[model samples]
Target: MSTSSPSNAISGASSSPSSEDVETIRKNRVLSSKLYFDISDTMVPLIYSSSYDIAFFGLEKLHPFDSSKWGRICQFLIKDGILQQSQIVEPLEASNDDLLVVIKSIFRTLCQKLNLLPKRKTYFGNLNSSSNVSKIIEVPPIALLPHWLVRQKVLYPFRKQRGWAINVGGGFHHCCADKGGGFCVYADISLCITFAFMRLDISRVMIIDLDAHQGNGHEMDFGKDRRVYTLDMYNPDIYPFDFKARAYIDQSVKVKSATSTNVYLKKLDKALEVAGICFKPELIVYNAGTDILDGDPLGELKVSPDGVASRDEKVFRFAKEKNIPLVMLTSGGYMKSSAKVIADSLTNLSNKGLIDLATPPLGTFLCVHM
Candidate 1:
């Protein structure tokens, strides 16, 4: 119940790069990056690593976030006979060079300055530092550790895999180019899309953010950029009340607190229809957060586990019907049941033939846009 405020340490006024500079730097960095390595034909595009789970000296328990859910999701899938452990693709850590592509210059500078401090001194210098890194991640203990440790343990796994990947961790939708918030320390979604634009040779991308909370990070980062289209359906009464960021969303579907599963799915069906007519994207990034399930302390919506599975099915169906490569990130769910719900949803996706783990070559299905 100890939730961090949305407006905590991050400033909404962080500077954006000039359009020309953004394109130049983002493209160069993404092209020179090593995170987008080739996967073998035998490996599925589902990206995950044991290192993705965060265990901050057992202090993570003090926060409301589920630090271990990422590993648990994979475990459930394996236990249920839906996937084999060897089938999952382990991703390379997103190095500083890779992150420079999408991260704001100011943030990069701040991180560098923090890294320069002596090991004897507290890296952050002040516990109440307004850096917004710890507050946004909701793990106050992280404020005491070195920034390098935070990046290695928490953020490295969020790097983009192939065009079609399920990052069992990372849906940090609240962080942006120059700021971090709502337990989101980095802009993984933005970074992923940028990598796709350059490495995957993708142009138009659509973001289907179905988290219980509005995906303000990517919205803020991609605001007014015509390359990306956002369809965010969230409970407006939740943590981040970012009206300015809301303006960036192409289609905003507001679901009130305590709304039932039936009504939520009905709205999603309509939203997908509207989105189809609005944009013809080559790729879809689905932020599938399970926090909306009933009894979740944060998301507050009343959707059942079955409803969550159906929601993912609809999104996958939409992408398949459109012949677009899809990248899914398990974003923003912290309840103990969050992992199980996501695993079940993935099982459902597999059962429906949306995701084929046993296929010899994932590229056959994913190379549609390429």
Candidate 2:
């Protein structure tokens, strides 16, 4: 069984919790737990993201939470002292391609490392048996275009914009071309974006990944396209263990060297400013990762929930204020405090202009509703 604490994920929020809000939080935890539990073990692949959450949130401390549901789901994958493994096979690999063999071998090795059983076949199953695999969800692409086009839409857009912003879970930046993790960075995002554009017959797009981890995959995915400008940020020394020795890259920003929300945001603000001054993108894709929150076990920066909230607000509002069409996605988030980010983001979007809530920041009060 895995063990991680909720407190370990967040140091503290900026304000005190009201008793009523506390009760609501208690109820939400119960609801979230139940929602996760009643789900099937077969759904593990579909919901591995939850395990990512478990790994990040410190499942043991999901107080007032009964983990039996997630526990059973996790353990089943470990039957016969082995967990199951899956891989995203390259679409272009030849039938007898050595790369395919290598990928299969790697899957076997990973299963062995995790003590997991190998389930043969490329995985493409529904998260739930009743669900339609054909209806699989996809991430859109990052849009890089000119400015006046951005002003025509709800989000900041470029002149005659024709791109989209895609989102996904975790900062899976390692899954890029050069990384040997076959497929392009932002592969999911790109595929979705391409399909959307083809279906819509639109052209031009740029991607922006704001996760705490460098958008390594996105960088590789769109490496050759001058039209695709990616901005990835993360600490180079930690996690992904493999890239630690590499020199500080100009392509992506390192949060570890300068660990503060102000610096990170300033860096991002600068990147966006440059993009605005140069690219003039029409469609903006924003990947809002919550792992940057201070005390996040997986995060290196110390941005507060409010800081994250501000980042989201600024990004979306800027786009909206600029009239840019945008598509937003939940990318990386290791901390349960991310729950607050999600709640507040939606609240910010929903309570875009309502006033007289009597609360200093309306976002804080919405957590209770979440």
Candidate 3:
């Protein structure tokens, strides 16, 4: 058995638990966890680490997904003089205890597959079953590696960049607490929110999921919870045609395939307006996926590079106007240009004064100046 705390994972886990007990365990775990740590004054909330990139013996080439896109995004920011390498914060890995609270049942399943045999663990140190690994990433070759390596190389970066940080990777909205799929192995969004609720004195949260596909993972996890409100804009004709999850969304905006940038932005403005009136959240989680860009095989939308930048600016402005802390996750986008598109968007956010890499002057408005 793994050395991680399996008992805490099960406490108050059943369908019928007293609210007090649930709250206590959740708070206790959040308090004890190391994922939430203090950052130095010099570093910005933009979190990225070289470890975020996954590669081994050239196996990464098998998948169409750009595995090195995360690193490339940071590189572009540096090249453009918008971000400094020293200002980026490196996050601590989310230990098993930290993940168990949000992904209780699924945590056990992943561990079983990942820690298959004791001897394998000694040899590979982080071996996981290839069958299970292939399901989340959709890359067949990744399963051949040891599970420990996958966690260290792929999942750990996601765990580290959870709250108030723009993670270069993660936004696995397809995987839920009980299952994992659609290139998502862990419920990082759910985990981040849960930690915030327990540790950060935050109660209400808004999820602005602008990925091409519906964010079914977070939808499934937070659907019943009243504290979270989801604004999902996706192509209804694409993968994961989940009608059940759609019911859970607070505001659902469907943009058809090949939708122009103008049309997409117009609909987003309306959606954000409606969301503003419908709910007031303490924090905003922006799932900024670039798959909607033109020529993307999966997203099928035709949004240009400038459109993506505008979209991010709008969301940031929304949060800044409300003065709510925002956490952005670069979710799904498969094309090679996806990294450049994302980098340009971040640069746009900085240029528009929506987000600050360096410390800003007091009383400075985060919204765009008229």
What is the per-residue lDDT of model 2 for residues 1-370, given as tens digits with 9 covering 90 to 100?
A: 0112323322344333334443333333333321111222232111222222222123224322122222232234334222333310001111111112112133333233243444543321111221221111111111222323222221111001111221213223444422322111223344333333433343555566666666555454556656555655667665554453122232465678337778767877776666666555556556666777887666667887777867777777667666765655555565545654555544554467421111222121100000
Instruction: Write model 3 residue lDDT over 44-139, tens digit each, in one string.
Output: 777776766777567667766677899999999989888889877766677666666775443334335344322323111222566576666777
lDDT of candidate 3? Answer: 0.76
- Candidate 1's error at 277, in angstroms? 0.7
* Cα RMSDs, all models: 8.5, 22.5, 6.3
Q: Which candidate should be chosen as best, given TM-score against the real structure?
A: 3
Off by over 4 Å in 2: 1-173, 177-186, 241-251, 353-370
CA error at residue 121 for candidate 2, angstroms: 11
lDDT of 2 at 149: 28
Query: Which sections of candidate 3 miss by over 4 Å?
Result: 1-19, 104-128, 145-161, 358-370
Ranking by lDDT: 3, 1, 2
Evaluate residue 359 in candidate 1 and report its C-alpha lDDT on the 0 to 100 scale.
60
Clash list (residue pairs), candidate 1: 136-183, 137-183
